[model samples]
Structures are given as C-alpha cells and as structure tokens.
Target: MIKNFHQYYVYILSNKPNGTLYIGITNDIQRRILEHKQGLIDGFTKKYGLDVLVYLEMYHNVNDAISREKQLKKWKRLWKIELIEKENPKWSDLSIEWND
Candidate 1:
C-alpha cells in the first residue's frame, strides 16, 4: 500500500548511529519521519535525538538508492553536515504536520 508511486526513498537523519540516526526508505517521507520526531516510532529514533531532517535524496530507481546510500555511508562527519546544510540550513525538521 505505498503512496505517490514512490515505492521507497533513501534518506538520512542525523541523530547518530544507534544513538540518533534514522536511515530509511518510505513512500511517504514527510509523514514517516514526522512520526519519528513525535516519538511515534518506538525504536532508536525515540531513544536518541534523531528527529532532524539532515539530508535526503530522491531516486526513481532502486539502483540509485543503493549507490547513493553507499556514497553517503563513506562520507565524513563534516561532509554529511555540509550536505544537510546545503538544503536545510537550519537543520529544521522538514516533516509536515509534525509539531515541535
């Protein structure tokens, strides 16, 4: 039951690995992450502070997903931060319907 025809997505949220990071794919990106920020997900995202929409890349095909993920994974901490800042300078949560 995926929506928008976007079967999945490749996203990067900065909390930390197991500490706060949220790397996942979903058709409804905005809604899914909003759930995380609201502590809706009873997992690592809630335990840590991984509620920020640090970085996100869209892909029409899964191969792009695999490639981009691998690229991001190898990036340095500063590099990751820069990438997020490029689009989300404030590090604000881009999740709509998600309240602070």
Candidate 2:
C-alpha cells in the first residue's frame, strides 16, 4: 500500500519590521508568495504592500494550517512581532531568494 501526503503553510507577510502584517494559509508557499509579490492578489496585502515573507509554519493537515493562520491573525501586533523576531530577528524577507 502507498500513502500520499499534502503540505499546507501558515505564513505571515509584512512590509517591514513592525510594519503592516498579513496572515495567510496556502498549500504552495512559493506560488502564493509569488502572487502576493506580483500584486496578483488584491485586498489587504496588495493595498498595504505586505509582500515580504516574514514568517511561516508548515503542516501536513490543511485544517491545522487554517487554524494556526486564524489564531495568528487574532494575535496582538506586539505578540506577532515577537513571534517573527524570535525566528527572524531582523525581519528579513525569508523568500528574498525567490525573486522572479
């Protein structure tokens, strides 16, 4: 027997350190981030220029990813900043190398 696995991502995008933030969930982080960077998706992210991939969490279950995304979205700005800084001290774009 064979089993297949699916990946989901709970990601955070920001314009700069302590700047506007966006929380989202997607199965393809690369493609999703690319779309945001290209302004292909309209709304909050595009309006605020939150294209930098500042933080991310991956899971095999979509529900888990969605739950995490929603939870993060409800978090206070300072808490979110600390979460990002814990993993990304300088708030550098984690997807900077994916320039396309």
Candidate 3:
C-alpha cells in the first residue's frame, strides 16, 4: 500500500499595507501566486493589482482549505486585517523571494 500526501492553501493578497485584499485557495500556493503576479488571473486580484501575499494558511484537506477560504471571504475587512497583522505585522509579500 502507498500513501499520498497533499496540501492546500488559503491565501490573502494585497497591493500594499492597508490596501485592497483578495482571498483564495489553491493546492499549489507557489503556482497560484505566480499566476497572480504575472497577471494570468483575470479577476479581482489582477484588477486591483493585489500581488503581495500578506497571509497564508495551510491544510492537509482540500475541503478544510475551501471552508476556511469561504469563511475568510465573508469576514469583515477589519477582522481580516487583524488576522493578517497577527501573522504578518509588516504586510510584506511573503513570496517576495520565491523567484530568487
């Protein structure tokens, strides 16, 4: 028997500190972030220039990740900001160094 491992991500992107935010979930965080950065995603993130990865959560189950993403999307803006700030006080792009 073989066991397969999988990962899912719930992520938040912002243009800058205290800026417009976009929430999403993906099985591949790096690829998803790259797509957003390259403007391949034609929606809120691209329109708002929200390429900075300010917050992220990982899950082993895709369903859990999806649920969390939906929950975050429904949260108040201030509450979301607080959640991001709790883990990323500077609102820096967590994926900034991925290319290098």
Candidate whose lDDT is highest = 3
Off-target runs (Cα >4 Å) in candidate 3 are: none
True-structure lDDT of candidate 3: 0.94
Local distance difference test, per candidate?
A: 0.69, 0.92, 0.94
lDDT by residue (1-100, candidate 3, tens digit) is 8778999999999999999999999999999999999999998899999999999999999899999999999999999999999999999999987863
**Predicted candidate 2 versus true structure: per-residue lDDT over 5-92, tens digit per residue:** 8999999999988999889999999999999989999999999999999998999988898889889989999999999999999999
Determine which window of 10 residues in candidate 1 has minimal summed lDDT.
Answer: 14-23
The TM-score of candidate 2 is 0.94
Worst 10 residues of 2 by lDDT: 91-100
**Which residue pairs does candidate 1 place in steric collision?**
15-20, 16-20, 16-21
Against the correct fold, how does model 1 do in TM-score? 0.67
Write model 1 residue lDDT over 1-100, tens digit each, in one string.
8655444577877664223455666666778777877789887777776777666778777777877787877888677777777887776656533554
Model 1 misplaced regions, further than 4 Å: 1-7, 15-21, 38-43, 97-100
